[model samples]
Target: MLTAQATSTAVSATDIAISLGLLVAVYAVLGLLWLFLVVREISHGPAPAPAGVVEEETLPLPSAGPLLRPAGGPMAGSGR
Candidate 1:
């Protein structure tokens, strides 16, 4: 009877250990999947800019214009 009880306890301990090992393995797989996704995204080039936006190199520089004025209001140099 004592030997049977010892055997049962040993089996229970082994089952607990196996369950813990399986849990760790599952978490490891999930972590690996997340790492793969991150690496895949990084490997791909950056996403395209939204519509109606011009690249910095293609943008035109500001041209000289009348100094200061609220649109159609008195100009800065001209007295109000």
Candidate 2:
């Protein structure tokens, strides 16, 4: 539909460039805002896991013993 009023006005190249520039600027601002919120939340850190899931009695650790041989075992260096 051609309206007499609409046909009379002309759009310029500068107007189109400005519109695109403004669109990019708006998107950039939104991206930066999203990044900032993400960084702030990451700085706050992960939430602590629920304590109820894990409950165990602490037992004394087993004492360390010889790595390889018992007292009666044959020595490793001896030719067999």
Candidate 3:
């Protein structure tokens, strides 16, 4: 009977250890989940817009100003 009681106690202790281990594992998983959620929330914040610098727009057509016009062309200023 003593041996049987000793065996029961040893089995109960192992059971308790396993239970505590499972509890610790559960808490660890929950902690990781919380951390992941926080990181995800931070990452989800609006992404920074392409640097606030403004770009200048260029014209597709060539300038028709006097200096830019061909020297001997009619568009050189004397329309005649």
Number of the top lDDT candidate? 1
| Candidate 3 lDDT over residue span 23-52, tens digit each | 999999999999999999898996655886
Candidate with more favorable, higher lDDT: 2 or 3 = 3
Question: If candidate 2 were superposed on the true structure by all CA atoms, what would the RMSD be?
Answer: 15.0
Which of the two candidates, 1 or 2, achieves a greater lDDT against the reference? 1
True-vs-predicted CA distance for residue 27, candidate 1, Å: 0.9
Each candidate's TM vs. the true structure? Answer: 0.47, 0.45, 0.41
- Kindly report which residue stretches of model 1 are placed more than 4 angstroms away from their true locations once superposed: 1-11, 53-80
lDDT of model number 1: 0.80
List where candidate 3 sits over 4 angstroms from the true fold.
1-11, 46-80
* C-alpha local distance difference test of each model: 0.80, 0.75, 0.76
lDDT string, candidate 1, 1-80, tens digits: 67755665545777988999999999999999999999999999689999998899998756745653456655654555
What would the per-residue lDDT of candidate 2 be over residues 55-74, giving only the tens digit for each residue?
Answer: 34555444754535655666
In model 1, what lDDT does residue 15 have?
91
Q: Top TM-score: which candidate number?
A: 1
CA lDDT, candidate 1, residue 76? 50
